[model samples]
Target: MNSKKLLLYSSVFAIQGLSNAVIPILPELAGEGSTSPAVSSLLYSGYFIGALLTLLPFGILADRIGNLKVVSLGITLTLISGIFISISDNLWVLGISRFVEGLGCGAFFPAAYSMIADWKDSHQSLGEFNFLLNAGLAAGVFFSGMLAELEIKTAINIFTLLAFLSFIFLLRETRGQTPDNSGRKKDEYGTSKRVKPPGEPHENRTGFKPGMYLEKTRETFFENGFWKLWGISVVLYGATGVLNSNYADYSAGFLTKPELGFAISASYLAAMLSSLAAGKTKAKNKSIIRAGIVLAAAGILFSLKVPLLAFFLIGAGGGAAVLGLVAAVSRVSSSGIAMGLFNTGIYAGLGLIPVFGSLFIGPLGYESVFLGSGLVLLTTLFVKFE
Candidate 1:
């Protein structure tokens, strides 16, 4: 691969996996701050909230100003905020810093995904991206586990250093590189060779209108199969959130700091393999998606009896489902906008499910939260996407 793609992959691999690292170290963070695990989880929510707010806006910015700029800006933000995270003294500060990290991620992914769509077959390319994503998570988990053996602060500091290094590479790539405002590569003669993105008027190609973005998003919202597919995306990510936010607590006796980390990392490793396989499969999107939901539901249901097996089953199936959703969305709208909206659904589910599931923790017990996720995934069986 070229240097540009390499740098982008490195940045995404680190940024996406950063959350998994944090999950395993929650106890250390809580103890250091003298707070509860419940409070520490709000930090994840803070990141989700920032991602939820900025994805579409950043997508618009990428479409108008060029993806290279947006990604470079994102890398800068993540690098700076990640350093601040190492020094955060309280939940409030940590939340804010995580929020900034989320903003950077929100900006990076759609633009990066859009770029990948142009460089190669998006389906296969997306598979490679997922591999890096999960591989990075596994690496982060191992690193965090090691740091937990010493100090959580060291892990945070190392994480910041990695982000800084990624930023340097990304910055180098962006220099003297300029794509068109519409995010298309120029033809040899210096004119756009690709069609304009969704919702802009042909008469006035002058600049971005803030309102045009909203209109395109609204149009996609009402598209025939969009909401159905969007619902699946929501349920998928919600189930993931259910595990990430609750599994550490639930696995108290079954696993400890790095052990839970390793288990979750194994889950993502299975997902990475599954994603690569799915990309090569000719199966229909609905077929794979339904299979995935069913597989994950069964895993969650049997989790308490066999946690490791359950985690693997859930990750493997969920990987297929996630790729199916992204491929589905890409076909229906402007690539960047579609990806941005899709990400919004993902983080929305991530942010919302745990809040509602937390209620079940008091009455039905903590496992009930995962039970709710299983139920949510089960509901998709009766429905079809597109």
Candidate 2:
């Protein structure tokens, strides 16, 4: 990846880091924001739900116009939403602001992933993307925990400031151009090579028409193997959601918020290293994904026995499965819809699993939830990609 690609991926780092920055504070968000902890979690629910609802729509938009415009919009909304969240005393207003912030991030994701898919060694590039994302997530948890010790609002300031900075460069990068495809070169065998041309839109001679876009999107997402990949995505990512949504509450018995933040940071660091390691392997994507599932299951089961090292196993699996999923899904869908649907799989699991699983948490225990999620994931080990 070049400097431009690195910068582009940073936008996601900022968006995700900012969004997740609040997780460390979830246990106490109600007191700080003058609401209940359950309601405080609504802020997270709203964000992922917002991301879920818009994945297809914004994806369509990215496929039509381009990713840069969508990223610009996402960052801009994040900046504006931060302001509202900063001043608001009401939980309802805070939730609303978070929802809008989710919309902004939802906008950035598909376009951003789609952009990565267009880059050189896209598989490795996606790993690099995941690496950067984990780094950002780790930073967010650490800083947010630290900042919350002073004031809850201070934590929000960090990502918001980062968003404002990202938007500035995004505007500068996308100002007169879209992500450029004109600079690509062909090898001796006639394979096209990824090259930097800054950010400029790929020229679409077909031109976007309402009916045409609808037709293309339908054709792109509904083809054979699409739903299968989606199913796998939901299961894998939902497992992740189970881990994250319940993290703070689960850790409360064993660790402080800042200590938990350090643990979470360690988890992401594990994920970063996992992705980097996986990116170097020559194994089939299928094997990689299965290995990820096995690792995730082991990690979850281990957390039942030992919580301290659970982060490493689960985090490593998290990165591997996603890279495998992206590579796998792209094979099934030849058009622009692949990355968007992949993201939908992610946020859907993030949202849906926890919502349903929360019911079980109160009745059974965190162990049961982790056990159930892991067992469900292990069932997919036999699944084969076409």
Q: Which candidate achieves the best TM-score against the true structure?
A: 1
Q: Candidate 1, residues 2-43: lDDT per residue as tens digits?
A: 666677788877786675567776655555432344555566
For residues 88-145, write the lDDT of model 2, one tens digit per residue.
Answer: 7677787888889889878877777776667657777776776677778888887876
Q: What are the clash counts of all predictions, listed in order?
A: 0, 5
TM-score of 2: 0.82
Q: Estimate each model's TM-score.
A: 0.87, 0.82
Write down the worst ten-residue block by lDDT for model 1.
184-193
Spell out the clash pairs found in candidate 1.
Answer: none
